[model samples]
Target: MGTDNRKNLRLEVFGILKEAVSILCKNINFLIFTIIVSFPLLSFMVYYETFLFKTMVETWDLLSPRDYSNYNRPLPYQLITENMNRDFAYKLIQLGLLYLVPLHLLELFTMLLTIDLASKIYSSEDRPLTFKEMIEKPIYKAKLSSTFITSVYVLFLSTCTLLGLIWLVINYSIMLRNFIYNVLFTVIYGAAFVALLMKYLEWSAQWNVSVVISILEKVKGVEALVLSAYLCRGSEKRGRLLMLVFFAWGVCLRLPCLVLGCYEGGFGMVLQNVFNSLGNVIKWIACMVYFYDCKTRILEKKVDEEVGNVESS
Candidate 1:
C-alpha cells in the first residue's frame, strides 16, 4: 500500500510536468495567437515605461538640490511630497488609463480566444481548431458573466478574511494580559483561523472550474458558482495540488528574469517583458489543462457513482 502510494505520488508529479510540456508543444499556434493579440499591450507597456523614465528624470531635475536638503525624509516620501507635481501625476494617470483600458480589453479578448482554443483541444475528439474558427464560433457571454461573478466572490471572501484576521489580532493582543483570557482567546483564534482558511481553500477550489463551466456548460454567475461547488466538493486536495503546480510552473518560467536582472544591464527590462509574456502563454496553457483535468475527474467520478448505484439496484 505504501509502495503504491509512493508510486502514485511520483506519477502525479511526473504527469503534471509532462502534461504541461506536452500542451506547450501541441499548442504553438495558441502562443502565436496570444502574442499577436498581445502586441498592442506590449507596445503600450514599452511606451509607458519610456515615458515614465523621462518623467521621473524631469521630476528629479525639477527638485533642486536645496529642496532635497529641506526635507529630512525618505526618498520615496520626498518624491511624492516635495518633488512630485499633483497636476503632472493627474495627467500621467489620465494618459495611463487611456492605454490601460484598451490593453485590458485586448487581454480579455485574448483570454476568450485561449479558452475557446483549450475547449476545442481538450474536451473534444475533433481535429484542432484553426484560429479563425475558434474566434468566430466561440461563446463569450457565459465566460464573461461567470468571471465577473467569480471575481466578486473572490474579492468579497478575501476582504472578509483580511478583516477577520485583523480583528482577531487586535482582540487577541488585548486579551493576552489575562492568563485565562489569553488561553481562551488562543483556542478561539486558532479555531477561527483554521475554519476561515478551510473555507477560503474550499471556495477557491470550487471556483477553479468556473471558467471551464462557463465555456462547456453555458452556466453563468451564481448558478455557475453553485454548480462548481457541487462538482469540486470532494476534490479539494487535488485542486490545491494542481494550483501549486500552476504556481511552480509560473515561477520556473520567469526565473530567468531574476537571473538576467543580476547580470544584464539596461536591455534586461525588454528581455524581462518578453520572458514574462512567454511565461504568461505557458501559464495560460497549463491553467486550461488543469481546469480540463479537474472537470474530467469530477465528471468521471460522477459517472462511476451513477453506474455503481445502477449495478447495486
Candidate 2:
C-alpha cells in the first residue's frame, strides 16, 4: 500500500510537468512573446551571476594566494589576515547593493509577468492580457506589493539558513581537529542538517505557491502565505517534488557555464541565456499548474468530508 502511494505521488509530479508542456504547445504564440520579453532580462541576469561568481573567485584568490601544485593541503585559516577579511566583507556589501538587489528585483518582475500570463493560459481565460494590460490592472499593484513583501521574507529566511549552514561548517571543522569528538559531532550535525534542509524545502514550497496566490487572487502578503500553507497541507510531498525537479533542471542548465566558463562571450553565452529564459518560462507555468492541482485536491477533499457528514446525519 505504501509503495502504491509513493508511485501515485511520483505520477502526480510528472502530471504537472506534462500539463505545463501541453499548455505551452497549445499557445506557441504566447510562448514566443514570453521568450522575446524575457530574453533581455534573463540574459542580463545570466551575465550578472557569472560576473558575481568570477568576482568572488578572484577575491578569494587575492586573499589567499595558494599554490596549485599543493592542492591536497587545505589553506590554513590563520593565513587569512584581518585586513583581508574586512576587504572581503566590504566587497560583498558593495556587490549586494549594486548587483544583487537589482538582480532580485528584476527576477521578481519577470516572475510576476510570467505567472500572470501562465495563470490565464492554464485557465483558458478569454483573450490573455498583454504586458501592458497586465500592469494596468488595479490588482496588479496589490500583487506587486505582496510579492515584494514575500521577497523580503524569503530573503531573510535565506540569510538565516546560510548563517546556520556556516555555523555547522565551522563547528564541524573544529570537531574534525579533535578525534575524540568526531562521532558525537557527526551524529548531531547530521540531525541538524537534515532538519534544516527539510524546513527549507517546506518553506520554499509555500513561497512558490504564495507567489501564485498573490497574483491570481485579491489576497496579499501574509494572507497569501497562510492560504498557500493551508492549501499545501495534504500535498506537501508533491510540492517538494515539484520544487526539486525545477531546482535540478535550473542547476543542470547553468552548471556548464560555471564549470566551463562558457558564459564569457560569443555564441556560447547567447545560447545559455536563451535556454535559461525558456527554462524560466516553463518553470513558472509548472508552478501555476501545481497550484491549481493542489487547489483542486483541497476542494475535492472538503466536498468529500461534507458529503460524509451529510450521510452520517
Candidate 3:
C-alpha cells in the first residue's frame, strides 16, 4: 500500500511538472516580458552591491592606513579602534538614507508588475496586454502592499524556525555547549542542519503562490497566505517538487554568474547578470503556469460540486 501511494505521488508530480512547462512554453512571449521588465533592475543591483563593497573597502583603507605586512589580519580589524572612520561612517549613512526610498519603490514595482504580467498571461479570460496597457492600467496598489506583507510573514516564519532549531540543538547537544568538533559531532550536526534547512524549504513551498493569489483575488497580506495554503493543500507534493526543480535550475544557471563576476568585471559581469535575470524570469513564468493550473483545478472542482447540487434540486 505504501509503495502504491509513493508511485501515485511520483506520477502526480511528473504530471504537474509537464503541464507547467507546457503552459510556459505556449506563452513564451509572456516569459520574455518578465525578463525584459526585471533584467535592468537585477543588473543594477548586482553592479551596485559590488560597487558599494569596493567603495567601503577603499574608504576603510584611506581612513586607517595599514601596512602590507598586516594584510593577513581580518578586515574587521580596521574598525577595532576607538575612533573609527567617521567619513566612511557618514558616507554609509548618507548612502542608506539616499537609496532606501527609491530602492523600495523599484522593488515594489518589480514584484507587482512581474506578478501582474504573469497572472494576465496565465489567465484564460484575459487577453495578452501590451507594455503600455499594463502600465496605463490602474495598478492594484493593494496587491503590491500585500505581497510585501506576505514576504515579511514568510521571512519571519523562516527566521523563527531557524532560530528555534538552533536553540534546540544547542540545548540538547552537550558537544555544542563547549563548541566541541569531533568527527562524530561534526557529521551529526551537519546532517541535522541540512535536515532543518530542507524542512524549512518544504514549509516555504506552501506560500509560493501567495503573490499569485494576492494579485488575482485582490487579497493581500495574511489573507493571501491563508487562501494560498487552502488552494495548495492537496498539491503540497507538487509544490515541493516544483520548488526543488526551480532551486536546482537557479543553482545551475545563476550560480555561474556570481562565480564569473569575481574574475570578470565591467561588461562581462553586466552581461552575465542579464542572463541570470533571464533565467529567473523563466523560473517565475513556470511558477505562474503551475499556479494557474492549481487554481483552475480548484475552481473547476467547486463548480462541479455546485452544479451537481443544483441538478439534484
Candidate 4:
C-alpha cells in the first residue's frame, strides 16, 4: 500500500509536467509570445548568475589568507570574518541595488505573468490575457505586494537555514579533537541537518503555492500562506516532489554556466538563455496546474465526507 502510494505520488508529479506541456502545445502563439517577452529577462538572469559566481570567487580570493602557515588552525579561524573590507562591502551593496534588485523584480513579474497565463490556458474559459491587460488588472497590485512579502519571508528563512548549517559545521569542527564524541555528534548533526532540509522544502512548497493563491484569489501575505498550508494538508508529498523537480531543473540549467563561466558571448550562451526562459515558463505553468489539482482534491474530499455523513444520517 505504501509502495503504491509512493508510485502514485511520483506519477502525479510527471502528470503535472505532461499537462503543462499540453497547454504549451495547444497555445503555440502564447508560447512564442512568452518566449520572446521572457528572452531578455532570462538572458539577464543568466548573466547575473554568472557574474555573481565570478564576484564570489574574486571576493574569496581577496579575503583568503595568502599564507598557509595557519592551515592547521580551527575551521572557525578559516571562515570569512564579519568585518569585511569597507570598500568590498560597499561594492557588494552597490551590486545588489544596481543589478540584483531590479533583476529580482523583473523575475517576479515574469513568474506572475506566466502563472496568470498558464492558469487561463489550463481553465479554457477566459481568453488568454495580453501583457498589458495582465499588469493592469486590479488584482495585479495585490499579487505584486503579496509576492514581494512572500519573497522577503522566504529570503529570511533561507538566511536562517544557511546560518544554522554553518553553526553546525563550526560546532562539529570544534569537537573533532574528541573521536567518540565527534562520531556521536556527527550522527546527531547529520540527522538534524536532514530534518532541517526537509522542513525547509515543505515550507518552500507552501511559499510557492501561496504566490499562486495570492494571484488567483483575493488573499495576500500571511493569509495566502495560511490558505496554501491548509490546501496542501494531504498533498505534501506531491508539492514537495513538484518543488524538487523544478529546483533540480533550475540547478541543471545554471550549473554549466557557473562551471564554465558561460557568460562570454557565444551561440552556446544564447541557447542557454533561450532554454532557461522556456524552462521558467513551463515551471510556473506546472505549478499552476499542481495548485488546481490540489484545490480540486480538497474540495472533492470535503464533498465526499458531507455525502457520507448525509447518507449515514
- After superposition, the stretches of candidate 4 with alpha carbons farther than 4 Å from their true spots are 1-11, 59-69, 76-78, 82-84, 94-100, 125-155, 158-193, 263-270
| Selected candidate, larger lDDT, 1 vs 2 | 2
User: For residues 2-62, could you state the per-residue lDDT of candidate 4 as single tens digits?
Assistant: 3223223433878888878877776666777677668668767666755666666566565
lDDT of 1: 0.56
lDDT by residue (1-313, candidate 1, tens digit) is 2322322232243465555555546656655676776676666655554455455445545443354354332233344466567877785686557444654455545555565665566544435556676447745575676665554564455557656764564444434434363577667866786676556545554664664566556676677777777766666676666555555554564455444442233565565556655555554555555555555666777899999999999
Query: Is candidate 1 or 3 superior in TM-score?
Result: 3
lDDT of 2 by residue, 180-277 (tens): 53768766876787677667766777787887887777467778788989988978888877777776776787778767876566676667767767
Task: Give the CA lDDT, 0 to 100, for residue 293 in model 1.
Answer: 58
Inter-residue clash pairs, candidate 1 = none
| Cα-based TM-score, every candidate | 0.56, 0.77, 0.62, 0.77
lDDT of 3 at 192: 79
Over 8-65, each residue of candidate 3 has an lDDT whose tens digit, in order, gives 2323555555544543455556556555668657856665655554554554355353
| Pairs of residues at least 3 apart in sequence or in different chains that clash in candidate 2 | none
Candidate 4 displacement at residue 135 in angstroms:
9.8
Identify the runs in model 1 with alpha carbons over 4 angstroms from their true place: 1-17, 41-106, 138-208, 248-266, 310-313
